[model samples]
Target: MNEVAQAAAAPGLAVKRNWLAFGTGVGIEIGAADLRVSVVRLRPSGARLLGEKTIEGFRHRPAAQWGAEYNAFLRTLGAAHLAATVLLPRRELTVRTLPMAGVAEKDLASAIGFQLDSLHPYAEEDAVPAWARLKG
Candidate 1:
């Protein structure tokens, strides 16, 4: 598959991905109590940020709206498609160590989810979980 499709599928496949380009699309960032929207243009080295404005007059905006707006923005940038990456706040993600044996790919998420369910009683779905194996 191409880069954009690969990036989008990576998350669902339990792999990590990043948005390398805006591709004629905009990005919207939504927080629990805050909302942000921006359009961006990509360069070979970095990105040119545009539409750095806050959308007002909305009491409760769904996260999906932000995503759609971002995609539309990318289209305006002359990009045939766009890459979407959901950036979770650092505070929302709890990174910690865990002991893991020879684990299979299918079981890894469940294993971590099980462990985190205890530590994160509030909302495990709201957070992202990752792990690593330390050298002996």
Candidate 2:
């Protein structure tokens, strides 16, 4: 079985998992000086890197231009169907972790939502909050 879910937590991104034992994922990292894109195929056996691209000085270039270039790169590798996980530099983001040891998976969002305001400086109206539950 393959389940595809549109994550309300992150707009314009889709999460998919296959019980058939294989899937694909794309990651785009925005570094200090460049935009890097990579695609990988995940199977029960292992993860295989499909393709990658590094666009230098992406900040100086128009987003539409570079975005198209990146899109083309994915299309060339037949990975245009995958939703990319965009990674921003750590310093550029405010990262926080909470001890949700007893929080059930279903209530995770509400647990985070209850503490959202205290976690960041942005006002509720202006802030866009995203979180992930990591297994340590």
Candidate 3:
């Protein structure tokens, strides 16, 4: 990841063109009581697991402290460019699939977006809804 940084600072995964050659990324999961991280590199030959880390009682620890440890691990593995993708606990996420048989491609965004509030429990201000159009 960028700085042995906590995934909270860089919550989403961003791909770089150069990554097509390296295929390196870090996966971070925020669990109920701890945080887990994994760094992997994919090559034509196969995928290699470079490193893994877990921090217990993550909710109670200071961000800076655990974040430093996070950075240190990636620094040791020389994973400076890997984007950290953080996965929140299942309880924090809401999944809803809408059947839009007639929604035009251009209207897909607005169609799903308008229903975001009803899809999630969070208040209007707190909700950060994201969607994708799935194909069968």
Candidate 4:
């Protein structure tokens, strides 16, 4: 059996991959009470299934806690893939689609910054954010 299957078979197992070599990517989303995160294996046609983990009790302030939790998730899951994209709440964006306008072209970081500012309810300027365009 491969490492992936072994890890998957074990309860509460985390899978790590060298994203640069494997072309894998990570996705994260901020939820109301908990943070939703996932790992995606990138492919020419689409992203393949790898693994996902969620961090509970995510608060707005004291951002360091989130980092620590993420590190813990990676360590517990044994995931070494460093490239990650965090998903922001769509409602945070001050965008209305009355006429079905297209999505914004700005970098994902900027958009997340805006979302964090509004969703956080507290001022935060130290977190770094990055995102990639995912094909459907």
Candidate 5:
């Protein structure tokens, strides 16, 4: 069995990986109530979770304090060298899904941009929009 399998079998053990060899990535999501960080190793087969951490008490904290704590947590995971992606709070995002029968994949982003004013709650200039086709 691989290290991932062993970690799965042992509930309390943290998943370990040589992230440098795997070119891993870290994803951080700052939600209203908690902050979550997940380290993933991308492979030909699929992405595997190397580790993850969630910290509560984010709702009322100062921004500087939260940044310090988040940095410390990443250091603990040895994730400072990894590429990171941060997801802002969902409340700040405007998300919508529309079905267009003949929209080509190449024109999707442009099409979304053209319709942003009607699809999003905020003004087109104020809102940032992202779209992906849903698989049926």
Candidate 6:
């Protein structure tokens, strides 16, 4: 059997599956002063850029207006039933890499929560944290 089939059969072995299968996908980015959208087509071989557009005046507009504009833009692309991912501006995110040694998977969340205030600018109550372990 192939590696994929073997991994799927073994319950103890965790298999990483491609969440974004071969198809068109929309990536939306909401920036402080602009909104950008990109349509990409993914195949087993590679990815192809289908379309991309950026609009200004995000800082001056309200959330509802931006939502409407985004809907209209998606309509223009006819992006129906396509996988989509929205990315927030980098400025709005606080990213950190914490070195965790000898920590179990189940206890990582609580461990990070304990150090949230020190790792990020916001207090523990105000911050949302997510982490992934790096493979060597």
- C-alpha RMSD of each candidate structure in angstroms: 11.4, 11.8, 13.0, 13.0, 9.2, 8.0
Q: Which candidate leads the pack in TM-score?
A: 3
Q: Who is ahead in lDDT, 3 or 4?
A: 3
lDDT of 4 by residue, 53-125 (tens): 7777777546798788787776654566576787778755434212212557555446555555444443366
**Which structure is stronger by TM-score: 3 or 4?**
3
The better candidate by lDDT, 1 or 3, is: 3
Which parts of model 6 are misplaced by more than 4 Å?
1-22, 41-52, 85-92, 123-127
Candidate 3 regions with alpha-carbon error over 4 angstroms:
1-25, 40-49, 60-65, 85-88
User: Per-residue alpha-carbon lDDT of model 2 for 1-136, expressed as tens digits?
Assistant: 2343434445534233333458889998999989899899988667899988998888999999988898899999998888899997876677887999888999999999999889878766877888888978
- By lDDT, the best candidate is 2
Model 6 TM-score is 0.58
Q: For residues 1-136, write the lDDT of model 5, one tens digit per residue.
A: 9987987778544334323245678898988789898888776556788788786777788878877877777787777776679999768876667876798988888887787778767765787666678887
lDDT of each: 0.59, 0.83, 0.82, 0.62, 0.75, 0.77
Model 3: residue 63 alpha-carbon error in angstroms: 5.1
TM-score of predicted structure 1: 0.48
Kindly indicate the candidate among 1 and 5 with the higher TM-score. Answer: 1
Q: Model 2, residue 77: what's the lDDT? A: 90
lDDT of 3 by residue, 1-136 (tens): 5575654355443333234545888999998898899999886566899999997887899999988888889999998667799998788888888999999999989989887767877888877878777878
TM-scores for all candidates: the values are 0.48, 0.56, 0.60, 0.45, 0.46, 0.58
Instruction: Give the Cα-based TM-score of candidate 3 against the true structure.
Output: 0.60
Q: Put down candidate 6 lDDT per residue, 76-121, tens digits, no spaces.
A: 7778557679898777788778888898989988898788767777
Model 1: lDDT to the true structure: 0.59
Worst 10 residues of 2 by lDDT: 11-20
Name the Cα RMSD for model 3: 13.0
Pairs that collide in candidate 6 are none
